[model samples]
Target: MPQLQEPKLIAGNANMPLANAIARRMSMHRGKQVGLVDARVERFNDGEIFVEVFENVRGEDMFILQSTSNPANDNLMELLIMADALRRSSAARVTAVLPYFGYARQDRRTKARTPITAKLVANMLVGTGIERVLTMDLHAAQIQGFFDIPVDNLYASPIFALDIQTTFKKRMDELAIVSPDVGGVARARELAKRINSPLAIVDKRREKPGEIAEMTVIGNVKDKTCLIVDDICDTAGTLCKAAEVLIENGAKEVHSYITHGVLSGPAVERVTNSVMKSLVVTDSIAPTDAVKKAKNIRIVPTAPVFAQAILNIWSGTSVSSLFEADTLSPIYDGTYAAE
Candidate 1:
């Protein structure tokens, strides 16, 4: 087989720190220093986005690391425009590496006249010449079908499981993994299975968006240390509320392992005052100043995972193997050795 071209990683303003970290980790995996491609992504006075790749990427394998987080429209536009530029510049392939895929919650129409914005976003990316997509813990799994190109949805369960084991090693028998709502039971179950712990579900009735009416714990969490698992913690209304209910339902302590921390609005304030022992989220979205300073909020770096996945994709190896139980332990333990 012919040798693959060295990957060219670029980034927009969505999450530069994560992009940089991924580059550094990938460098370690390759036994050399690999840096990001110098690219300019800016806006005009009238708010028009502009993109210019300073380095030559002709016939190169390109990956644009961008998260469609807060200021979603602007960040998404940056990714689209950047992809367009790379395509026009004759890049052999362009993969969109979205740490946090925005508009993913709108995967389906709940009411009449509602639009599936997730599909729309997928269309937009494909239209912009994105050949593949790499995202983490999509709000809905079906969102992957929206793209005609290859979509690799990475899971955070492995990372969370390792952290949970290390943090609660002595109390493993007392742990109970929880899903904040019915829709997330699968996600919670996966983590529970990974940790060999019992599973619980928070059955909540939604009054409306960002509002919870009532919540009930489906399984016995009495005196157990509960760990709530969810995809996105937007506004944190559901997450904080779930923790409160878990504590009230006799859980000894409540913590959360969320994939994307789209902690918008009063999320930080709510989490700060909530009954949760801690809220652990991945570094998919760049943490705001408030998030960074929040006492109980912790961020787990995903650079190692992403770097390994990218390497696997480039080398025709199996990306899914990275999450296999046998292989997951070393990936986050700082070893990051390939299987």
Candidate 2:
């Protein structure tokens, strides 16, 4: 077992709900072991971030929890500065545990003179002296290659599967799993295989960046309940459009399962007007005002899953087993496996 004995967990201002949830799963409160001095993140006269970890972290295995979500640049700087602070404090190893790796979708260029922001983010983390990256459900698997150090890309599909199995147990016979677009076909296929249900795909044609035309459904969905699965839902364009198509194709009911709910700019309104029965999202990105007020939106916590992975990693066990969707009864059942 790796036994990161005396491992230290620190958190920043971003996504405190998720940080506290993970800490609870670890059976500890935040800042119980060491001095978590007041973090004063304020801008200077010219607008530059300043941070200092008031506690000693010398020779400790430190994990800093911060999500680069809304206010992406500020949160990102906080993570970078936290890592730098730990490194300067002589920590043995510093790991940036980002539940949501922002800008991950910009892994490649769609046009000339474009920047791969994902790689740039990785370079920034490397420059901050971070030794490892622990994140969940990246937009692209190859983003792991963007980092020079060990990057553990975790999946939330298994956790979601448990939820769906219980929620729709009675309707399993008439259920259908759907991918919002061609890019998410693999992810949707994996989830479908786990639930032992049929898979479907929506092929969308984009006349431009903002305008998406949902072309057709590649699988049978008539008289069946549809579950559209995707890694993230940013503008809610693809998800909403696909659900509309499914309903138009005689789908009895439509539901969505998206990992990261980066619901920005009128997303809640779009979902409210869409045909989806409900939108299930994780705590990857903190919910906004509209998302919280939206009647059809539901939140599924990923704390237990991330905590278990951390425990497994600390105990020197294989996290690969977490990928299989069959053993995920705890998520929807409201009970968890501690073994």
Candidate 3:
């Protein structure tokens, strides 16, 4: 068999800092210098998206790093158009690396006349020349089935577990891992297992999309430091309310580890005013100005993870091993040992 071509990385406007960080990590892995493909993605006066590639990509494996975060439509469109351009340019393979996949909450219809927008977005991606997808902590795992091509869904548990181990070193015996709601108990349990902490659940009744009717703590949390885990934190209404309820239930302190910080609307204000000691989120979605200024909100880098995944995919290796507990030691020290 012929040797596999070196992977080419292109980024959209959603999160350039993260894309650049991933590029840097990939460069370190390759030893010799590697950089993002020289490309221009911009808009015309009428708001039409335009893409131009400066270098040849013929027969090269291509990966587009774009997160469909806030202003979801524009970023999503940019990914599709970029993939189409690469396909026309005769690239061998095109994989979309979406750090934060928007419209994921609309994976299914909750009522009449509502569309499964997540599936629609998946169709749109496949309709473009995208051959595969690599994303982190999708809101719903079933979204993977929406695409005909291969989809690799990575988890943030390893990163969060390592951070928790470092932050609460002497307080492990006093820690209680919490799920913000029943739907997230599995995610919370995974982290609890990794850290050998007890598990708790926040039983909440959602009156509507952004409102909560009642909430109760499920397990023992008295005098214990509680850590809530979830996939997304939009508006932060539910997260803040859960923190309040946990405090009222006699928890010592409340913190959170969320995969995607889609902190839109009044999320920053609510988090600031809430009882949470701190809210930790991944760099899946780029932070806003307000988020940057918030004292209690911290961001964990996912670039190393994505960079390793891209390299593994291009080399036909196992992506799941990236999350194995034993193999993640390098992540804690800001280094990755490439295989």
Candidate 4:
């Protein structure tokens, strides 16, 4: 790998903690001091977004870290404006690093007059002059195709598998990984295979956004510890209902592992009162104060993965190597045993 100019990291108001953690990992990996580029992202009294890049970015590889979470529209606008500002400032390349891509659930339309907002968001980013995109665990993998530019969609399965092994240890064989809906069966099945656990699916139908009809457990879960896996946990309606039904069907205990925790509305309340034993989520989107205060919630840092990916992209190396669920190498100090 050849050395290009040092890449510049810029974070939006979306997830500063994850961005800072990523920067720390990058500095450690490079064996050199690395820090975020100075930038200001703010809003006016009328709630208009503003973005300003303090340092010169001319010919520098710029990575803008932003997750369109709670205030999806606001954070999204911030990212777009930042990318536009970077291009106008003469950046060599602008990579939008979206750990949790919002509007992804609406990748397609089921009705005649619905909008494909995910594609719209992609078009907006590309039109704003973003050269590339780096996101993780999109609600739909096909969303990557929506962008004309190169898109890297990272996975959180390896991270969850490592933590599951560490947490359950000898009890993994007594576990069953479940998908809350048929759509997530592939993700759950992959994790189940990694841990050698039985796979189950919660057959569910969505009545409307943020709501689910009665769900049925597809596989045997009687007396087995159940682990429901999915990409996003928003509103908690589906997860809470799935956990309740899984327990009603005789599961010993219900645990959840998800990539993005967009715990909106009464999500925390629902999880706290639900039958789920615990909910583990990655720090793709920053956790709210309520999420941190919840007793049944755990957070796993995802910085090492993103940091390594960014480094690989900057060095023109193979990013696919990071996807393997083997022992994480020198990059992560073998801290993450992917299996």
Candidate 5:
């Protein structure tokens, strides 16, 4: 069998820390010689994006790591320009690595005459000559269908399950996994099953964007520690409300494990005053200064998972296998309950 060529990991300005971390992991996995591709991605005075790859990526696979987070448009445009640059430079394949795929919530039109921006974003990428896409915890699974190229949606559930097991080890039996909304029950149930805990749902009605009309806990949480799970926490209104409802229903403590901390607007303040004890989010999107200053917020690095997924894809291995709790446990395994 021919040896697989090492992919050149490229970083965009969106999330430098995460990009560097993933590059390091890739190097470790492929031996010392493999490293990140030296590149330049910046903007002109008029805010025009410019990209240049210093090293030859000709006929080599290139993975561009970027998160369309805050200043979403600029970051997203930067990714498109970078991919175009690589494609024009003759790179064999360009896989976009979006940890927090922004505009994902706008996958569908909730109102009449509204455009499906998610499909537009997918179209933009395909138009840029990109070959594949790798992302984590997409807001809607159907968004993958929007792309003509192959798309791999990674999950943070395994990581969250491991953390939950370690944090609530002795109290596993009294722990409940919660979905802040009906749509997220599957994600919550998967995590709950992994730790052998019961599942709960937060039934909420939204009167308008960013406001919750009514909130209710659908399962018994009295005397139990609840872990609210979701993909995104933009504005954090739903999260805070769910935590409050859980507390009011007698949950001993409430915590959250969200994939993307799009903690925009008054999210920090809301979380600070809420009944939730802590908010754990993956480093899919770089946290804002406010998010960094929040006492209750904790960040879990996601580079390791992305690094492994990149390697697996390049090696023709199953990316879904990474979600099997037992398979990825060696990285951060801990006994969460007495067997």
Candidate 6:
């Protein structure tokens, strides 16, 4: 571990539950160590965001736990201000640990003259004097390259993979990992390999944003249980539509595994009414009430994973192994009870 004289932990206004979880895992003296500022955001008559960090963080290694969840802009501005405050306060280092990096989808210019919003966000973080980044399952991996400072893109796959093994024990081999779109083929394939299963792909043409995607599944999903894997589940049109296509193609069962559950608009209703059996999401960003109460939804806790990463980072240990999801011990792996 890099022996710093005094290490500080700063919790941003976003995802306080998760931040507290990480703090508890660290065994830090709760409110005494990791402090929160009022950060009472207000919109002026003209609609603007203002923030203030009330805590003093001189010569401290500060880590700000925030997620760019809903109201992404507001939460993002809060994080930026927190980092700038820590930097200007004479803190030794500042690392922005975002469990969910919002606006990650706009990582590239799909069309001519389009802005790469993901890159823009990266610039904002680096410009604000963030020393490093520790985030999970960003919409695109290339978002890491956009940052001049080091960006550790963490993975939730190990937690999900282990959950899958226990959730469907004997039937895992009969599974065909399906990607909702060709872009997610790599993620689906990675999960499939962890469980030693085959992979399938769903090819689709986007009709419009927020509309059901008309997809033609590319692989043989007939007579096999299908799991559609992706990084994020927003609106969930693609997942629901993909499930329909797979079922129409003779899939025995359909499920969706997504890392971040940005279930905005009609996502919950769509998934509830779709042919999908269940939607699995991680507790990276806190779930909305609809998702929390949905019978067809299951959440895998990422608190332990985030906590472990924080400890490792603080101790100056390598964190690359944490990104490999399949190696983690499952909650139902016949051991939690013993503890």
Cα lDDT tens digits, model 3, 6-25, are 88899999999999999998
Q: Residue-wise lDDT of candidate 2 within 47-100, one digit each (tens)? A: 788877767778887878889998899899989988888888898888888999
The better candidate by lDDT, 2 or 6, is 2
Clashing pairs in 1: none
> Which pairs clash in model 3?
none
User: What residue runs in model 2 are displaced by over 4 Å at the alpha carbon?
Assistant: 1-4, 28-40, 325-339
lDDT of the structure predicted as candidate 6: 0.79
Q: RMSD for each model, in Å, please?
A: 2.1, 2.9, 2.3, 1.5, 1.8, 3.1
Clashing pairs in 6: 158-325
Q: Write the per-residue lDDT of candidate 5 for residues 69-130, one digit (tens) a residue.
A: 98999999999999999999998999999999999989888889999999999999999998
From the highest lDDT down, the ranking of the candidates is: 3, 4, 1, 5, 2, 6
Model 6 earns a TM-score of 0.90
What lDDT score is found at residue 68 in candidate 4? 90
The local distance difference test score of each candidate is 0.90, 0.83, 0.91, 0.91, 0.88, 0.79
- TM-score of each prediction: 0.97, 0.92, 0.97, 0.96, 0.96, 0.90
* lDDT-better candidate, 1 vs 5: 1
Which of candidates 1 and 5 reaches a greater TM-score?
Answer: 1
Worst 10 residues of 6 by lDDT: 330-339
* N/CA/C clash count, model 2: 0
Tell me how candidate 4 scores on lDDT. Answer: 0.91
Worst 10 residues of 1 by lDDT: 330-339
Candidate maximizing lDDT: 3
